[model samples]
Target: MTSEAAQYWENRYRERGRTWSGRVNAALEREVNGVAPGSALDLGCGEGGDALWLAHNGWSVTAVDIAPSAIAIGAAAQQPGDDIEWVVADLAEWQPPRRYDLVTASFLHSYVELPREEILRRAATAVASDGLLLIVGHAGVPHWAAHTPHEGEVVELPSPDEMLEALRLEPAEWTVLTKALVERPVTAPDGSAGTIDDSVLMLRRNPAVS
Candidate 1:
């Protein structure tokens, strides 16, 4: 665990009641709904929105985050007998206990220094054979974010191709399902609104791989 990064997220959630919308991410819902329910791993699951949704959809889910407070909040909202496990751990060092049919990392970016690619590669490894790995990242900072303190700063996030390259999966061993930039309207932290680009990358590990 990166102690500094963990502390930063904890403080951010503490100062702000919630850092993100409690609802599941749009891309996650769209991608997951078409598939059959199975074991899932939600990496960097802030407040367990995706995990809760998956559990409700009949998926046995394991959700992890760096902030214990966030996990506590999510745990409190879990319904009785829901097959969701909320875990507080730093993704920088933590490893998934078992492979899963679906592994998702939605907007897992952080201002704190961490090896993003390395963590994502670990996520890919946690996907079971013939399973799916979905990674969603901000293609660029939203125009509304320009009004914030980061004004005039160019925030460059990884492109879908760049992320695919970082994963270094063999073409014969994995199938690239989707790689595109999706635009969506959003309300920023200060209530400013604008369209944001999301870099979506979804891959499936071939069951034939030894």
Candidate 2:
């Protein structure tokens, strides 16, 4: 992405005191609850909710986002002993330095021009052998967004099947743990309670693949 992308997000964060709920994503929290903690990577880690949750749950976390203000808010909220490495970098140009046992890209959507498919493919590749990859995203335009006009563009989100196909993982190398659309409750912009579909894909790399 260009500087416009970064500027757009930076302004969003700066304009709003806190844009997101300071809690781990619902899907991620449920899926990873019983798993053993390990090194984790959080792509597009705005405000670092998921990353902070992982760190508190014993997972070493690397949280990366394009907005420095968002990263700073999350960093400032950190408790002592939280093992989190916060990075401010655009996911379009950012590369993971090492493999991670668990990788998460929750709501990696953007209003600006974004290479969504390519970024997701790279995220899948960063998983180590026997590692897990989890992606959660809006399945379609939310009712609120559809009813109301919004600034910037509303990027169309892909279905779970489309996301899996885009990743192009070798059949023999990955196990599909989850591929489904789940409804999550949320408060709309007008403060009305509602639900939205979230395309969820969770995969585990087969162990000992050479």
Candidate 3:
């Protein structure tokens, strides 16, 4: 069943060419840039845009997604000198082979009722001491509200505080550097444009010894 969803995403990417606009997620690029180079894992890395960016920026990345087609596309698109390992696996079942300096999950908004705490726990566990875990996703309803009218299927979002509490990080372990609801314009599949309000949260892991 989960494999089917991955295939669906792969097909979607194939049909859409590239769903992402070839730009790294704004919050991650800004907050995670200064961290020292180390192993990085990109969960739900669609089309490898962000993974490619990280590889170019000095991080050796293991980019994972549920879709094999997406992984293939990303592998083919990878440029010379950009080092990235693409894996096809569901995040719930996938485990990192080693700890990392940075762990990121961006725009992963599916499974609203899913146990995000467990996911965050795994992410936190995968991080080395002094490492960073960066989770960025759409804060509120998705931009394509008209297309997805179903209640639980679409627009299911989590508050920043909810995520922070779920992760169980003490105030001393991490700090919320940015948390805000931001409105941004979005273009629809029909070429129509609209606005979406997204909640953004950026957390920085404290390097100080616990």
* Candidate 1: stretches off by over 4 Å: 147-156, 188-193
Model 3 TM-score (2 dp): 0.82
User: Alpha-carbon error at 145 in model 1, in Å?
Assistant: 1.1
List per-prediction Cα lDDT, in the order shown: 0.87, 0.92, 0.75
Clashes of each: 0, 0, 1
lDDT at position 15, candidate 1: 80
lDDT rank order:
2, 1, 3
lDDT (Cα, tens digit) per residue for candidate 3, span 1-210: 656556567677778775667667767777777767778989888778789889989899999987777787788878898879999887767888898888888877563334455776788777766777777767655456545555765534677666667777677777677776667677777888887765566666677663
Alpha-carbon RMSD, each predicted model: 2.6, 1.9, 2.9
User: Of 1 and 2, which scores higher on TM-score?
Assistant: 2
lDDT of 2 by residue, 27-92 (tens): 999889989999999999999899999999999999999999999999998999999999999898
Q: Give residue 121's error in model 3 in angstroms.
A: 2.3
Instruction: Please provide, for model 1 over 103-162, each residue's C-alpha lDDT reduced to its tens digit, 9 standing for 90 to 100.
Output: 999987876777789999999999999899999999887775534435433334899999
| The best candidate in terms of lDDT | 2
